[model samples]
Target: MDHVDRTEIRPCRAADLPLLDRHLPTPGAPTRHADRFARQEAGTGTYLLAWRDGVPVGHGQVRWDGCAAPGVRAAVGECPEFNGLDVRAELRGQGIGTALIHAAEELTRERGGTALGLGVGHDNPRAAALYRRLGYGPVVAYTDRWSWTDPDGRTHEEADPCTFLVRDLTTPDA
Candidate 1:
């Protein structure tokens, strides 16, 4: 189990908040991750970071909730055992997204999670391809709230902006 150089993924700490937020959903907006980091710090969730030469280049967060997306009912946020991977946009490719996801899955499995989950913008076909290539599969069709203060922090909780995904972390074989 040897990983590559130039970028290493690790568990996130309080001191890494600023670094994590840098590649997070929003630019120059710590408020975007305010709610998420608070819970992770409070022991309700976990955040993973991807670093290059001690510099934070990517980040992902895992939570014990379901359906974080918006406009979906009944199944959105239903299960409490699943985890989510909220990564940064700046490092979407270059293996950063996949590395961060693998790191988060490790942390989630260590935390007793059997299933891994995440949501991506419906229009982001590139992201969809990336996730699919990394072993993630779509379970349900859903959306996220687009606002001025969400992870991307624009200020509009628009409806159905993304798709829901859940991957089996146990079966590493496809």
Candidate 2:
């Protein structure tokens, strides 16, 4: 927790690709970081990183257009969606993920959002508990579906059962 106190959260920069590749390589989705950066540049989303001792440790994405998941869109309207949160395997439980989520929440609030949404996979009770502790409440149950291109350019699809959640950013604790 003390180290988490020293963690810095900020938007992903062009120079971070290599650093991210070294520490957080998404081999199955080789161009993920670049694509997120492009979304950031396009003003449709934000890619945030958490740095500790000058090394990247965690990351998250905020889609300003809300979640593309149909159930989420239907349930939550257009509130910003916080997704793709990940922390270094060795750094889990150290608060890096929480810091990243806090940063994403602030980014949403700063952008005039009254609320923010996220999805917790049904099989991930740990994450569900964390989000619940963070004040996010379940909104809808849906299949979280998406596809990603592998390094070889083969596309793979995923459909995980999930519960969409939303938090009221207007509240002080949020």
Candidate 3:
């Protein structure tokens, strides 16, 4: 593992959106990742960033949802406890994303959350492996298929499946 000797955490702001959006998947499908971020910036939820030096390196966000733990009425303003963490392409795998995600999870727990969740395409084994290593586990699996051709004239889709891996906040390692 590479050494990340220095880091800082701050709130996500409008200035970071363009950089963050570039790292996100296309919006062909519906997801609250982008929209919820907008809301967070508008004082709806908590949004934070993890920076290296003076440059933006990673981010974490928290938003409310109607899907809390079982049997309870998940309120709109309740913390859903997920994040769209993006580590800059140049700085990935150096533990930036991991630190950002852990920061979000910690904040969610401080806010009384019992669980935290995030989605990843099943085809992206690299991301899945990272999440798993961080102690998140599969909670929901579903399909989000799409296709795109490359400059090499090849195409692929999300034929495999996608899933949301959740780590319970009340449990250890959360």
Candidate 4:
């Protein structure tokens, strides 16, 4: 059996927030995982976390609607979106990311989403390739903008060239 199979993927819980923050720290800011967990608790969306031996190693979130890229938001319509996918640096290439993606897909399907979408940073070809391998096709290219607070609570905005990708969730094979 694969080592990744030994890892458990499940919805985020309040108890998991601290460990998530430790393992996936956001450098100069509060852990983004905490915010996602809050969103999960509020019933706005589902945040999935991967654990190995009681340690949080991966994270991803599925949004029922809205996307940063205008093209994707217009094209995918009401599809759920997978975002904020991250695996611990040392644990990459061990199937953690793939497992997180699969969990997100299953969650979207359970939510009655007929399709799922995601955006990949243009600078990150490796992630784009992984999405492609998982059956996601490019829909449009656009720029994404967002802001984050630094450790000192100073906010900064960022813009990145990105490609939006989508995959039909209506079929099991998709």
Candidate 5:
């Protein structure tokens, strides 16, 4: 038997929130991890967190309804969108992101999504490259819409230039 080393990717739970917040903390803004976990607890969507030796290293979310990318919701209509993907800065290049993406794809497929969609910021070429390497192709160019609250509770909005990508999960190659 060939044994392979793999990071554990699992759904976020209430107890995981603090650790997730510590790992993915936004100093001046409200903790994004907590918000995602809250959404998970509320059943808004499924949020996945990656663990390595009991340490939180990566996170991603799957929204079955729509995506934040301006045209993605309209274009991919009804497909699950992988969102908020991030890995610890120190863990980059360790295949953590890839593992998280694969986990999300599997979950999407299990949920009956025939396609998976995502958006990568124009400024994040490395992530875009990884997405391309993993078989995601550009579907449309649009502004990614999102908002976050500052630590002081002030809400800040953002619209970033991004490219929406999608992969057909129905294909064996995907």
Candidate 6:
């Protein structure tokens, strides 16, 4: 994929939901953008979107509440968690995902957070390697679990083993 020369990272807004739905639709549960935006409005977290040429290219969620996994919570006490980072399949490897991560880190620092945490599924070595390269270190291993409803109203659960990584924001390259 060609590198995006000028990707803009910003907080998601209600008006952007339509564009997101068209460009980055979450098929199973498509109201995600609205929900995350609502959470942002409530001061819970920020859902960031990466755009190139006015097209949504990537996104991520910075959870002020930290990881839901008990082990991660216990090990990375009070740390903000960066979750659900996704880049358009055709535009990956061009720094879009990295920019989204950097944006999330900046948001954390702006909120007076000293560190940030994220989970990489055990099966996803590529993502883990990216985090390591960006200064995150594995803190603990835990079951990454969550559930979501489909558009048809069927709920699904997931429980995957993963390693939670934390980065010290005291230093940008740490």
Q: What is candidate 4's local distance difference test score?
A: 0.83
Error of 5 at 171 (Å): 1.8
Separate clash counts for every candidate: 8, 0, 0, 1, 0, 0
Give all candidates' CA lDDT scores.
0.63, 0.89, 0.64, 0.83, 0.81, 0.89
- A best-first ranking of the candidates according to their TM-score comes to 2, 6, 4, 5, 1, 3
lDDT of 4 by residue, 24-94 (tens): 77775575777788778788778998899898888889876647466767776757888989888889889
Candidate 1 lDDT at 171 equals 82
Colliding residue pairs in candidate 1: 66-77, 67-77, 146-156, 147-155, 147-156, 148-154, 148-155, 148-156
103 in model 1: Cα distance from truth in Å?
1.2
lDDT of 6 by residue, 1-174 (tens): 456558989999888999999999997777788888888999889999999999999999999989878888788876999998999998878889888999899989888999999999999888988999999999999998777898788999979999999999998453
Which candidate model has the greater TM-score, 1 or 6? 6
> Candidate 3: how many backbone clashes?
0
> Each model's TM-score, in the order given?
0.75, 0.95, 0.67, 0.93, 0.90, 0.94
Best by TM-score: 2
Off by over 4 Å in 5: 1-6
For candidate 5, report its TM-score: 0.90
Q: What is the lDDT of residue 3 in candidate 2?
A: 75
Off by over 4 Å in 3: 1-3, 14-37, 66-81, 144-160
List the candidate 4 regions with Cα displacement exceeding 4 Å: none
Query: Candidate 2 — which pairs collide?
Result: none
lDDT of 5 at 33: 71
lDDT of 3 by residue, 33-114 (tens): 4565677867657777776656667776665562333322222224365545666677778887777777777877777777
Instruction: Write the number of the candidate with greater TM-score, choosing between 4 and 6.
Output: 6
